[model samples]
Target: MSEEGSSYDWAHKAFLQAFLSKSVMTVDEIKPILAAVMSARDPNRPTLEGDVTAPLISSTIQAINERLTSVDYEIRSTKDQTNKHTVYALVNTTSDSLTQLATTFTPDAIAYIKRVLDCMFETNNTRNREVMAVTSIQASQLAKAPTRSRQSQVGGDEDSSIQAEAAVKSLTIAESEKVLADLFDQDFIYKSRANYYSLAPRALMELRTYLKETYNEPAGDDEDEPAIVRIRDCDICREIVTVGVRCSNRECNVRFHDSCATQYFRSQRGNQRTCPKCKGEWLGDLFVGERAANKGQRRTTGGRSSNVRSEEEEEEDEDE
Candidate 1:
């Protein structure tokens, strides 16, 4: 019952209903269920009322729809309607569907990742080297086959990834890149200081154990730090900040760690400073679900993105 309607129970219920329905739901179809969750008598206070009727959840409907993505449920534009306003659809998603490479990623991308991770747990030995190098060739093969086309304009950071993540009849190499980008964005993996990519610290620990048990790989005296993945530098501190918040502005989407954001905010005379790029206002609550931040809509330089479509987009040839 928090301000953002942070209710795990409600989200679970929505997912269950959609899972049981066994049908892709347009925004229209999912409205009632969203409304039912909002039908609570008083959002602030807890009560044991029986059945209740309340207004629709329109105020935060878009937010709710976007947040649902964190739990494998996502909203996508109704393909084929390019001339009209953007129409959305709800879907249940999984990791395999995201990258379109569940079967395998090239020759040994997965194996390579597992090896580097397992190497860390064995012993911190090396020529001061760690993390995996995502060479251009490796990235190409690991990603997949070629893509149809690409979109130059970015409506929002998440827009491109969402399009790639949707359920598809076929997979492509371009979508593979998008999947990797999402993984980086979500902290599943990160770039190393050595100008290469590797698994994140958390994944290193979790997957390290899994790989050891699953593959029975013996430990070798390879040297490196605790985690395979390393955090990038903070925009403000010019130092590595493992955890941070990013500005939403397109031009100046600088990310700052928790302390940095606080310090920066205070340095500006306790007034929120606008982003240096795009001049967009700084988001108050930096910690927010990226998908739900903008009501599941696309925002571009021109403003709310219209029917601009990507060239490589699938299932968009016909009107629905």
Candidate 2:
């Protein structure tokens, strides 16, 4: 069959349309959509044949991606940083003028989003502190338009400063709150129980390239030297690890998702789990993101309270 003929069928087209509506869905969530589409296509089909299995959904997505390649769009899958569930996101492979125009957000809204991303990934994310998240209060504080400094106005063209200030649209606090709520609804960002805002799985998958290019910097003079990356990848699965276990050695940059760390350590020969890069012992309790703060609180409290657990309990929790 020709590329055109084989690439997409009625089912594929329907699935594409359904996926575009949300741009993000988990494996479990996707199963129902697949079933609904398939059943709608042929209501009289046998129940067994109509069944939406994992393999069927995978093959359907594969076909859709093959067609989407021409337009630089793809359905990419990744594990959720917090829950470890599989998630699929329809992402634009290329970031171009056309892609920018296609976004639902206005130019001003996009700029505000960029600032939020900067706060989460650059300002809060550092070698010493890699929180990679912002509180709701902090996000709301960014609603105001950035002001131009008097020195910049005097040193450079005064018109340029005026133009720059005019370019940014100042959103009210209520408007900022609405924008954040919309972002959550669209699955671009997620709020934790602690009310901290972090990039959702869809955002991670969609903006992986952008994040790396913007935040990562070369650590050494040599071209081959690994860059000091703000967004680190899992040592096991190689996916971005925003919320995960970090190597006990502070100098070591090795990180893994909670599940990935558990699975990797399970395969180790000795009882003593060690970091693959650093020779130091792997401390499972050392975590990234907001979990790290909670861990610190537990330590500061200094007792076998309900919040604190033994090493054995930690291992059991990992297994669960």
Candidate 3:
């Protein structure tokens, strides 16, 4: 029970009640609730002036803050010097709370994972390369953390080897693989494959649901009128191919400008030229598929063919 002499204690109780209704509050924001607490005040003493109430409010807030410190909770308040005010939040500062915050996958993490998927798709080398790409994203995130506070030493700056680059595109493929090792241990994201990752079934289901409910921007898409646009790119030269020749493969729509295709074919190991991405030869993949399967095994200089290693076969050999 608050003593009759302490108006601040009464105000403290009222502010606590106000905190239940809001996650955060500024001094001005909670004044109305404090004012209402004064409604039951005895008229015996002269009413406290608005200027007099200021110190009492500060005292009441300080009392609650002191109590919060004794527990694992804190009344975190940040002052805005520019605005000349402070905003406060009740925060749980326990180890469990810290662990939860660190482990939860943020939206930015999801975006980075998406970019990794896009990178793999672009390369068409969708091998088991989780460590190759995911680790980079994690490293990039760590590098972005306040390096001064991130130290392992007593007085030195954090020894983070990963340097935070301005953009994800700037990161090399090797760094992505490094950070992915941490994400793998977390167990919320990756799936067990032949040493590669796609996504766990749990993550896949959640992402599918999120996309259907949040990202299906199918409303305005149907009503738009179609417009003719000259869209082309030279696959070999990688330019805005204004003039080009398409690969002879029917399924391949990739273009190469006049002399570019000739030069591209000329650089081929053998007489045949093929689509770089699809591995389609002049016609269909009639012989291209067999050739590609063997190309990795066949030596260009020597006529000997090395055995192609299967994901399962490699694991079996390692066990022996």
Candidate 4:
């Protein structure tokens, strides 16, 4: 047990139980849960909604995490890729794919999921077109596709052939759809309006290390080095930036979350922003995901009214 375990109280336990039930929650969502737990603990001094401050919640989570450290379970937080809203989730610290998804899925289902992930992160995600998402059609096609051998050698080894043969038994379209729906229901992945699937905030938070190690290459400070980096982090927040802006210079891999780019460019002095890496022009317009698809439409911050000034315009206004 951790040193803080002695200080753990009934309220904390109750909060943990509530958090465990959902596994993932937003800051706004957690406030009510904490308030309810506190209110139930002491009816005489019922905790009102107004009583739950950011500091109070932070401290409670801190204490809870301390106790959780001993058990390899933690309540982690990250921003949603689309909306940029903060999200919190109780995650297993174990890094393996088996430990992460095996709790809920069978061996074959897990294999199918692995293939989907491979499509999302590797096959589809590229320098020229960094979609970082898989469409329903693409996912369905994967069900009928043969599993690639794991071996790297020129002649496939016996073990590699065995692994491929034992890989996900050819799932039907219905089975594939069911798996996708289950993943969405569990908050591991989310389906966009266009039927595109990407990693959810909960998955990003829990599988941060796993994704980085599995997809991205070792970090190198040298800008000239042509590293095969599939999964890239935001220049500002250092978190994964799947649906975000990329540098105009294709060679320069610096990318930023739309919200992060707005805040970052707003701080810069000139109208012509420069890439932090290559020092080339930062075309504030270039983007990935839905933003890339809807290039003709005017972009708004935080999904606010379209009448509102664009992020670049707002930055320009502040400069003046």
Candidate 5:
């Protein structure tokens, strides 16, 4: 049902208020606050807007009541005749039910519901999304890899396009996984199977359970901790990180923590990157004729430096 404010932010604010007060609040009390949050507008609105006509408001409340009822969320409405005020109180549900509700939503409500639920309940959307994305990629890949019988068909444009889509899907999955892997060092932290790396299902389940217990339990005196970023320490600067900020060099595929490498590369606009350790131009010929000079010599700074020194020594001998 349509409401005055964006449902996502509104619901989050409502959840927080309900959690802190240790008491149920009325719908009337929550509506204006939620409306303001959703819009990110000044909280001092002249008055609550929308089809706030009694019937429309009742219908919207009823819709929420019905949705909440399926998941065993208790909601009550009360009006104080003397004060001329109305309020809605939302009671918490069991942790299991909350997790289920957060992860599964109707397509129409998915976007708004996800934001609200994530902010309030703290579900593992990253893992959930990664699982869904990877499964989709696997399905696409399985559908491709044409059977031996189809190899003879040369002009299969439709098949080729389908295969291409599958390839793209696989790449997307890989990229998403890489981001998480780099952030968490999951490849090293967890085991790999057939080069398909992942944390154990039990570990992920534990993470989900801990997050739910930590965030969704009864309100308490302690403040919650912020989200953790997982990254490796930089070799040069030795800064801890969840993901490297930039490559040590474009060709090296070596990454470093942002703080460690920021001084060297952050100011550059483009194509002006250099090695973090050696400060050599990424593609410059440090070994001007090394390939011709020594067939077996590796293209490395030490070898290039020694070659330069050798050349200078030979020129000095000629001068003598």
Candidate 6:
């Protein structure tokens, strides 16, 4: 297990023991109880055993039962029956639940984690250029549209010419401009600005073929490279990082290919840093689910009377 996880495990055990000990439980009292329990036990030990250790175990367990009994009437009534029982009896946690929690974060937590990642990835430059290329294409569409319009006006019956021009302008073929443009237009593309895009969640994934073709790196293996590798797909383009690189954020262990990282970071400038998966703050924790949901609920409820009136009219029209 990770060192931090180990510490939390020790802390959690101590907390349970201390929390159960007191005649009267108060918020301020928890820390000291925790401190006492931790002081008595070896922090590194996964399991505590032996006859010599029995008294400490019993004391801690009794304290927990007492505290739980005070809080729950069911426990209070069953308290006598569990007097000499093992400490594990009072702690009701499933191994599966604990395992799942350690491996996976809740949706809200994932968002929070992503926010921090977004900030770190936004620091790259090359990736930024790619993003700008796509945005420029979109914004310039009106200007480009006029050219098509002019051509159509001059040659109304020449559908083949129009198709050729469209094929040329679209990034589908081989030109860098159209290729970049189409890549940015994908829903998986999250653009921070004119020159930035990211391969975020709810978007397409980077293909192996594209990576091999665009980046000089080979498609299969990198035997010469160090065992420790940092690679990330572009959050906007769904392009795999061909360049060797790692996420610069010390706190975050994410890695990305140089090109992919650059695009992700550049797209993040003057924008929010968020993980595409969890949307969590890379540096801190912030829960926005409740607020967002509440706002949505308010919007849904606000125009209800008008919506009802429209629905009634539609039904009446059908009847007529």
Q: Which one is best on lDDT? A: 4
What C-alpha lDDT does candidate 4 achieve relative to the native structure? 0.77
Q: Model-by-model lDDT, in order? A: 0.41, 0.75, 0.43, 0.77, 0.36, 0.33
TM-score of each: 0.25, 0.81, 0.28, 0.83, 0.20, 0.20
Best by TM-score: 4
- Model 1, 20-106: lDDT tens digits are 453233445455655455454346643322321222233344455566767765544331111222233344354333232334354
TM-score of 5: 0.20
Per-residue CA lDDT of model 4 for 113-202, tens digit only, reads 878888888776655456778889989988764756453346777776776676548788998899899989889898988988988998
Candidate 5 off by > 4 Å: 1-22, 26-28, 38-57, 80-85, 92-320
Candidate 5 per-residue lDDT, tens place, 206-300, comes to 23333345433453555675333222234554422222333323233233433445554666678787675566564422121112133233334
**Against the true structure, candidate 5 has what lDDT?**
0.36
Off by over 4 Å in 6: 1-186, 193-195, 202-208, 219-320
- Candidate 6's residue-wise lDDT over 1-63, tens digit each? 133223334444555644335312322343355344554565554332222243433444454
Model 2 lDDT at residue 106: 72
| Of 4 and 5, the candidate ranking higher by lDDT | 4
Cα deviation at 305, candidate 6, in Å, is: 57
- The digit string of per-residue lDDT tens for model 2 on 107-210 reads 76766777788888876675545678888987998877678522235565768777767787878888888888888998888998899998888888888888
Evaluation by TM-score, superior candidate among 1 and 3? 3
Provide the clash count, candidate 1. Answer: 6
Candidate with more favorable, higher TM-score: 3 or 6:
3
* Residues 88-165, model 3: lDDT tens digits: 556555533323324444433433455554332222121111111122333344333233221233453333323222
Task: Give Cα distance to truth, residue 72, candidate 2, Å.
Answer: 1.8
Could you give me the TM-score of model 3 versus the true structure? 0.28
